[model samples]
Target: MNVMAKAEKKISSAFIYFFGSFGGILFGYDIGVMTGALPFLQADWHLENAASLVGWITSAVMFGAIFGGALAGQLSDKFGRRKMILMSAIVFVVFSVLSGVSPDMGEASAYYLIIVRMLLGLAVGAASALVPAYMSEMAPAKARGRLSGLNQTMIVSGMLLSYVVDFLLKDLPGEWAWRLMLGLAAVPALILFLGVLRLPESPRFLLRKGDEAQARKVLSYIRKNPAEIDQELASIKETAKEERQANQKTSWSSLFSGKYRYLVIAGVGVAAFQQFQGANAIFYYIPLIVQKATGQAASSNLMWPIVQGVILVVGSLVYMWIADKFNRRTLLMVGGAVMGLSFILPAVINWMMPNMNPMTIVVFLCIYVAFYSFTWAPLTWVLVGEIFPLAIRGRASGLASSFNWIGSWLVGLIFPIMTASMPQEAVFAIFGIICILGVIFVKTCVPETRGHTLEEIEEQGTNHGRVKASNPEN
Candidate 1:
């Protein structure tokens, strides 16, 4: 707590936190870049009428991410969280260039981009799986939410940056604009790769591998009181020993068995709902949505994403501020209700007045995005990082992440088709129902994890015959 000690902690915290969650920026960039790029892509390909191919191209990253998350999760467990992230960043930078050149494939460029994006998605999915677990392990429990929430903050900031880049490049020839938007992600990916090079391995992972000296050394930079560093190490060692003695299996199937089952369900279900609630339909295709609703010109479409992106960035900042101060379940339930209502009211207005101004739909969707930014967008990862037992944290995080991508893939692929066959509001109404169900899932399954250590959460899970007392009985 001395002034110089405080200065050192601040510097160390900044380094670890920024590099630790920097992967989120790459992931968010892909999300926002596509929103703007899609319109320009249509301009070059003249695929304005080919909805299926466009949907496939848009959904490709989420499709690849499904396997990437599951694979990286298990691999990070065996190899180490930091190593997998480094590998993923390298892959992301390389594929980003390949994605930029897809326009060279002539008529087949759409399919080519799809193939490249699926490959690039491996890196995106891996980052999604790795960042949360890495951040969780590095952060102390009392401040874990704020630190881990930094991942979401970085993600939205990336999205906002992509929007600005897309706007800047919009006046370029159609093919070149989209190409640069896709390729520009390489710069940030390279920065992440360099930043991570200086980071020490997770202290917990080091101890598990029997490198106590290195683990203590890394913990020293993170903790001011030498005794506090030793205290956490001893607690971590004790928890690992108890789990080993109790014969808890880290096998993939073990997630569904006995004690780990309930926690896995809660963690993975939240991850799934975060996507299935259908936020990506807006993130991926907002420009097209605005055009169809209001008869807005294609040239004017890129501006809308900036407006929405700003809301998301601001909302994430708000979440970081209140993250440690509020209960997780309270924020999730309230946010979900508002998000569901945002979708429902728009649909209802469209139903009641077929001639309703298209701007009204745009407004409601923005409202949905605003609520999601503060709630499920950030909190889902927070829970995914916290709820799993250490023995299977990596594997479980992978499972949760894969489910998340699966929902995202489905929403991205089908939203265009659904809108073609039905009213936009009608499609959104279905998403509204999904959001409400997500609120109920939070009420039933998730336990409050605030103000508790990972070891304490594990021991509490042990004491309960089924779930913690905080989780209500069925």
Candidate 2:
């Protein structure tokens, strides 16, 4: 009986990992597709090259994302996690296809493309909030961090997949190459949407929504003993009831009240800095950065991003092991400082020896990616899962993640213009500066969540505890 119970628990967890990681697939595909697609898309569509227009074409999704993240909490609360995921898949399919087909502004298809990207943004925002929340809820206390990290791992994998495909297809000599690249996203989106059809609704959402039977069934799939399932369900229901009685309603003011206020500030800052740390500038505009550093032709530059993506995938696993061993706050600071130093090295090398060996620049960039993949990539998601209580997790995480994506959008939209207008050396220097400041902010403000349970982390923040108690598991 005990062994069978363990097997069931393992299968349930595996289910969560597979479904949860699909969310990362969407994230990676969108992120990876745009980087290589943008320059060619802009050229092929004959779009106006205005900075603001470029920003719109690139970052317009943030606008819809702002709404998507803001509303995801309420909608998930009202509708169900599975429903919203299905909606996200539908949105992905619709907009991704449109983005590929959009003609220039004067053409009738121009506005349609913009609208689709904006819609895609909403899906990004919603999935960002929902997937992690769902995973956190489904995972056992012992495995939460690793399962949640799976989402980030999949995202980087997706990014790598995109880069490899783009490299393979770049020389096809037809505008359709980019379209096919963007359209490939629809395949996974459909599989994800269909997968959602079979996934059990999140037990937390079910319990919170007062669907006790469904919650019991779902809990049964995870917790083998009826007694354990009953106890857990009771605790969740009581927590849900107390949460409703305490708040009565969700509001913008809820973000600023008591302990939540500090969390809100910290959460938003973490999300913003995750992007502001200048990771996207590398991911979205690596070819441009590589071109500036190497003065290489366009064809030669396509391979650099693929190398970076591969390094990132390998780096994230090492970082995940570290995340389990060290204090998250310290890890974040060290990562920020490392990235800051990495950025400076390249900028200085480029300034001092513009014609330096391309291999040297590549080595520096690979180091930067190594630092980013292990620290910023997975830890950011871990913190988001740890910081908020179940009651406010959806809304708070949504808003924080939305801000992060918006920051990514801003960098992506502006990098081309910044590179064109500002010296590459200065821009890289500015990125280094931001990373340094991020180190300071994280060191002082972010809490260490390495071994603590999500509920414990919330209680620590609520009670204003100076430090989290060490986890026995660690």
> Model 1 over residues 1-474: C-alpha lDDT tens digits?
477555534448679888999999998998788998889888888888788988999999999988888888778868999999999999999999999978565668888999999999999988877887788778886666677667888888899989889989989998799899999999999999999987878988898899998788788877778888989999889976865754454577877766677778889999999999999999989988988887786646888889889999999989888887888899999999999999999888877888888889889998998999998998898777778888877567777877889999989999988988888888999999999999999998777777777777766555552554346563
Which parts of model 2 have CA positions greater than 4 angstroms off?
1-13, 46-52, 104-111, 249-251, 257-261, 358-360, 389-395, 452-474
List clashing residue pairs in candidate 1. Answer: none
TM-score, cand. 1: 0.89
- lDDT assessment of candidate 1: 0.86
lDDT per residue for candidate 2 within 142-221, as digits (tens), equals 67777766778888888898888788888765477777777777877898998777677888888776688878877777
Tell me how candidate 2 scores on lDDT. 0.75
Residue 94, candidate 1: C-alpha displacement in angstroms = 0.6
For every candidate in turn, the CA RMSD to the true structure comes to: 4.3, 5.5
TM-score of each: 0.89, 0.88
